[model samples]
Every structure is written in structure tokens, then in C-alpha cells.
Target: MHEVVAVRATIPGMTTTVDPRTVFETSGADLDAARAVFEQAYEASGFLPERTERVFGYRFRTVGDQTMSFRSTRFDARMVGEVDSGDQVSVSWVTDGGGVLDVGRDELGLSPGRPVVFPTGRPYRFELADVRQSVVQLDRTFLERIAAEAYGTEPGTLVFDHTAAPGVEAVRAWNHQVQEASRIVLGNAPVSVLALADTARRTALALLTTFPHRITARQVPLPTGATGRVRSAVEYMHAAAHTPITTTDVAEHVGLSVRGLQQAFQRQIGVAPNALLRGIRLDRVRDELRAGTPTDTTVASVAVRWGFAHLGRFSAAYARRFLEYPRDTLHG
Candidate 1:
């Protein structure tokens, strides 16, 4: 039997209230019924136990664009299938019990504090015994946008190095962040839109930093010419102008040493990379302020969104470039 509850969940950092459709309890002792229920609830494709008597409990909730779910099962089952993540990334952590997950030629042991990060298109096989877990799902486009703003490029593939052992401190910190995020998603805490966006951005950055990906590697080299290198760097700056990135990050992205990149910029662009980045960020801030409405949007928020942290400096730069105060532009 499954019980559905219509309850409003207060999302932390959201100004508006959201009513989430929740599945509070779902359980069945029969194998086929259990399999059908699981598939309907999670859209999971797999073969479950046919004869063994098992117990299952599931709870699911959604907040804005994200979903949080928990599942507990006390039976031996083989999940030889996949969840259609459909342009979303799913992160699951084992809160209790353990399991074995096999993806292609690799097999991972799922235990407490161990996280599995994967994009939605891959197929996985799992053998579970009395396992309980929590899962968090975020839109792929949202994360990609954040990555482009932060890294100046879109990630190629969201693949985690499951084979690599995470450090103790890193694992602990990641677990803490995940726990807090889960609480906000699952609990009834009133959240504002600004706060939600901030949390999502922080979570995406943390995931990118903690996980290993092909794009994050420093193996790719830029084109074999000064003009090409300078153009590439400039393009990256334009894409990531809204992010708080340093010149060193730009240099590293184009596969050049910091000093080499600086020299190239001087020779080709006649200005430093950091200066160009600042100019682009300033333009972005002006554009946003111009487009934003006076009631909901503020000059400080727009400036901060475009990576301008110091209000005084940001205002001075805006006045010098646009010949008007940012507040005037926003109001106008």
C-alpha cells in the first residue's frame, strides 16, 4: 500500500511557498507488486526478486527544481536497470546498510558516507541487502550553466572517478554539505529565491571541486599561436565573466603557465587578461541592471551577480563606463 500526502514544504532560501506532492509510505510483501510499485515510484528499470518475501519503504519530496528521496528495503534484490535521469544529475548516499553497484567493468561498494555521482544516461546493476539510502537530483542544464560561469567552459561529461579513494577530510566535508542541503530540501523551512539560488550555486561548485572530471584536467594545450591563445583566453573570460575567477584560472584553462599567458596577452591584446575580464563583467552588470525591474531587482544584487563584490568600486567603475550611477540605470 502507498499513501500520498499533499503537503506544502517550505524550501529554505525561497520567498514563495511550494506545495510538494509527497509519497509518504509505500510497502508490499509480494515480489511482483513490490517491483511494480518501485518502478512506478522511481521509474527504475530492473528485475527484482521474484519469490523472496521483502519489505520496502519509500519517501519522496520535491523543492523547486530539485528532488529528494529516501528508500529502505529489507530483502535481497538485483536492480539491473537504470533511471531515466533525462538531463539531470543524481547523487545518492548510503545512510544505512550496504550494497554492491556494478557499472560496466567497474564495481563499487556502497556504504555509509560513500556517494555515487552519475549522469542519468548510464545503466547500473546493484545487489542490495537491507539497504537504506537518500538521493538528491538536480537539473543538468542548471549545473552546466553554473559550470560555464565558473570555469569558462562546459564540462564534457559528468563522470566521477568512483575508483579513486576520496580523502577523509574531503569526504567528511562533502557529507556535511550534503546533509545540510538534504535538510533544507526535506524540512519545512521557509526559503527565499535568492537563498535557493545561492545554495544551488554553492552545491554545484562543491560537487565540481570534489569530483574529478576530464575537463578539470590540465592536459589540453591551446593552439600553437599567440593570437589563437589570446583569443581563446578572451573567449573564456566572456563566458565566465559572471564568476569570481582569477587570471591564473584563465591561464590554466588555456593550458599555459600564468607568466606565459600574461606575456601573450601583452603582445597580442595590449592589455592584461584580468583587465579584459573586469571590463566584460562590468558590461554584464550594466546589461542586467538595465533589464531588471525596479521593484524586485537592486543595484547591489545585480553587481554582485556579475562578480562585483565591493559596492563602492563597482559603482565607480559603472559611473566611469556608463556615465550614470548604477541605481539610476536600474531605476530608469
Candidate 2:
């Protein structure tokens, strides 16, 4: 049976390091112990073994709220495994070994140089042989916050399409970013909270751009009539107000031409699409300024965070809306 022979070590800067050596036999007990190690690192599921009497090794490290893991087996053995990711998305790259992953209705071949993206709340199965891979687990809340900031709306049910492999250039870029993030999080260099936040935001944005998802406005169906179209467009704008999107993007998203979308909004919402977008962004900025700490955050930072580029205009609009200056709200 596999035995826990090592103690978990916690390093400075929120890092956890663990190296667990497991002995596998012909019994089910060893299998359970092996599965426990996987569960502790990522998600838990069944591991069906095709051979016996092998040693399994696992090395895990966590840095700045991200979990990284390396897993390998001593002997060549065919195995079937499944995992339910719960609320965390896992990005895995096969460093030295290869396998096949069955996600949803698609079976994808996993090999060196090809990275796999696993969305949260999805079940995936794998048939592995001598698999040695590194996995990074990103929290769902963190990703959703980044998405909301980028798209100007609450992103519901973020999905990653894993049916096909991403492009080579994209994979290389992501690998570079992942390595840089790891270095920043694990290295001895001092990192500020804002710097780390920026890195995380960039990484999350890159992932979203590289992978296709269901968050686009085009995926949303327009209602049966013009009023329905207007409603959909406004809802999309309100949700995406924080994003740097144009009226054209909004119109295309709701399946309308620019003129059509404008006419619909003017008739139904009594405001143009651009006006609605600006108003929503202003509201978001005001809310953040009111809720943020003045010591750690500034009015300019709050305005910039919500996509208000012109400081003078933003300040004037803030005063007009709340009957007080943005600085006053932040200080209070």
C-alpha cells in the first residue's frame, strides 16, 4: 500500500511543497492511497490500473493561490482516471509523457507541447501511460472577477472548449507566461500586491483569449421582436459596462446592425447604447469608490479600474451623479 512518508512543508509567501513517494502493489489499498494524493492536489476520481507492482511519485507546490503538481509512475502501465474539478480550472501540460483525455463527448490526445484546459465544474476521464505532467489550478472566483473586469459584467458559468488543441504560438506564449508567473510567485524576489494582481489579471485574460467560451453576446439569443433585441442589448451592455467594448461590438453581439441596434435602444430604453454603457461604467466606478479603502486605493485608480480613461470627465460625471466629488466618496 502507498504510505504517507513525508511531512508537508509550508514556505514563506504562501507556498506549499510536498513530495510524496507511494508504493503500489496488487491490492486496492495502495490504489486508494495513490488516489488520495491526486485528490489532495486537484480533484478526486477513480483510477483503474492495468498493471501492478509499481511505484508512483508526486511532487506538489502552491504559490500565490495557485497549485502546481507533478505526477509520474515508475513502470509503464495503462490506467484510467477521472476527475471532477469542482470550482477550480486546471491547466495541465504534459512535460515528458502522453495520454488521451475524454472530456464531454470528445476524446483529445495529450502529448508533450500540447496543453489541456479544464473548465470548472466539468468531469473528464483520462487513459494514461507513464504520464508525467504539471498541472496548475486557478480559483474560479479569481477568474470570474477578472472576466467581469474585462467584459464589464458578471460572467456566469465560464466554459473552456477543450475539444481541440490550441495553436502552437498561443501555447508557447502561455507557457512563457506560466513560467514567469511561477518565477514571480516562487522566486526570492519581492513582489508587490498590485504587481501580482496585474500578473494574475494578464494570465487570466490570456487564457480567456486562447480558449473559446460561452460568454460572448453572440451566444445569447435575441428575443423574437425589436423590443426583445433592445432588452438583450441593454442587458448585455449593463453586464459588460466595465469592458472596453464599442457600440458596434454590442450590436454584433445581439445579432443587429449598428443602426438597427441604435434605433431599438432609442425606442425601448430611451437612451443610445453608448450612453447606457457610459452610465453603467460610471455607476460601477462610484460603487467601487464608495466601497474601497482610501488609504490603499485612490479615486483615479477606482475610475481607471472601471474603464474611465478621462480623469477630468470621470470626476465631473461622478460629481453630477452623486452630488459629491469622487475624491470625497473615496475619502469617506
Candidate 3:
């Protein structure tokens, strides 16, 4: 199911009417009219709008097992130019078509799977290139608060880099899952709304933590009435460690910078980042070693399966940590 969320802001006796429709469809001039409506929505959201061209487009909104409206589209590549005077940050994930995004002075290529974020106060440009996107915007203050919580550092100091990092593949997978959940939330699954909202909140928190920063604070705030965001992030990593994992991805999932993420892990787990990752990999290897499976199983296969990128290095590391060669375990 397809879904969109539209929020509206209206001013009496204004030249424009803003209606943010989550899921809706239009065609011909009507499509252009909807684009205009979106432009108004952007303006109402405190963004300065530039000229935008109209193209055929479709949108849908949902709530429970119900969907509202749907339409198909065919148009020359359409574009919308936007600037937020208030300097809000937007965290967005693309569902279709790759594009080049220019945020301030940096230009980055965006593709399907991974999520990207940009600050809105500056001039930015994007060529969607037949792109379909699932996006959400956060107020600058809110983003700062979340970042501060993750880093245990000063707010408004986190700087996001759009480049991919280790475990990026894992992040992409999670992002797609969030997009699907978003679709359900906007489509028609009341049962999913709360879950999706919680997911959205967690995703936002994680993305913030992925921003690059130096360590300054020793302890970050935790979620109230629970171990908090940091614990949730650790659990997420432990649960998904067998999958390709990266510190940045985990940090973003928990809303901390690489340094902050490292600091948190060291404080809570008593080990460094790579150490923990290696331990996780080794633990999985040990489990396989003890399973007593077929004799044809090779140590190299087990190493690769646990994400050892190099067989020789994996063997040496395994011997160093376990005091036994992987081959010895495989043969024994």
C-alpha cells in the first residue's frame, strides 16, 4: 500500500491555501494545482519556495486496513525548489530513482535503501531524476535535542556527512523497512500506527547519532522509565550483529555520533567498538563450531558467514582471541 501524510496550515485572507494531504492523486492541471498546494504547504511550514514545474503525480493515504486515494503518473521530470528560513533539518529516505543532492556546499549522490539528512536553512538543490521518496522533516530544535541526548554533548554541534559508512548495507535495509512501515502507517493499519510512530521516533534518534562528532560528554540521557535510548541501540546491534553491521549505522540507529557511540559502548560494555564487533563475530563462530554439524564445513566458510572479509586475517584473529586455530576447531 502507498501512503503519504499531508499537514495543512491556513491563514485567513491569504493569497494561498495550504493543505498537506498524506495520500491523494491528481492529473492534468489538477496535478499542477496539487503541486501548488504543496508549495503552499512548504511556505506554511516556514520554507521559502522557488518556482516549481508541474508534472503528473499520484499520492495515497491510509489508516487501518483502509486506503484513501491512488493515481498513476507520467510527466517530464518535475522539480520543487525549497529553502527553510528557519533552518530545520530534514531526514529523508528515497524509495525510487537515484539523484544528486546538494546541501549547502556539499553534493552527494543518493540511492535507494539508505537514508540521508540535510539542513534546510541554506540553499540546496536536488535532481530527483524520476525519483520517488519517503521523507520526514524535523524541527532544528528537536534534532538538536535528540543529538545532544545521544552524544551527551552540546546541542547544535552535530554535523552530518552524507557519505556511506561501514554497515551501510544494514542501514539501507533498516531504512527500507521503516519506509514500508511508514506506508502502512499512512495507508490504513491502525494497529501499525503506534508501532510505526515508535519506529519513526527510533529511526530519527538513530539517524541523529550517525552524524560525525568528537566526544565531549561522558554520559548521555537515557529514555525515561526504561534503560533508555542507549540500551535500545545496544540491543539493536546485538540482535542484528550477524548481519553486516557498522558503528555509524548503529549510532544512527540510536542517534549518536561515531565518537559518542564509541564512548557509550566503552562505558557500558567495557570494550571498544572493533573489539565488540570482533567479539560478536567470534561468538557466532564459536556457536557454529560447537554445533557439531557435517564434517564438510570449512572454517573459512564459517568465518565468511560471520562477516570476516579476509580469511587469513580471520584465522589469525581467531587464534589470537580463542587460543585455538579455527582449523583446529573445524577439524576437532
Backbone clashes, each candidate: 6, 4, 25
Q: Judged by lDDT relative to the true structure, which candidate is superior, 1 or 3?
A: 1
**lDDT of each residue in 77-113, candidate 2, tens digit only:** 4567776555566677776667777634478887877
Q: What is the lDDT of residue 270 in candidate 2?
A: 66
Error of 2 at 93 (Å): 0.8
Model 2: colliding residue pairs: 152-239, 152-240, 152-242, 153-239
lDDT digits (tens) for residues 1-332 of candidate 1: 54445454554555365544243444544556656666775555565643323444433333444422333344344344444344466666767666676545477788887777643333445665555666666665576667677877744334456556666776677777767766654556565556666666777777766666544322233223433446557656766766778899898766567998889888876787777778788888888888988998998888878888899998998899889999999888
Each prediction's RMSD over C-alphas, in Å, is: 17.4, 16.3, 17.6
**Stronger candidate by TM-score (2 vs 3):** 2
- Comparing 1 with 3 on TM-score, the higher-scoring candidate is 1
- In model 1, pairs of residues that clash are 12-191, 13-191, 13-192, 14-191, 14-192, 15-192
lDDT of 3: 0.53
By lDDT, the best candidate is: 2
Where is model 1 more than 4 Å wrong at Cα?
6-30, 50-80, 119-121, 154-156, 216-332
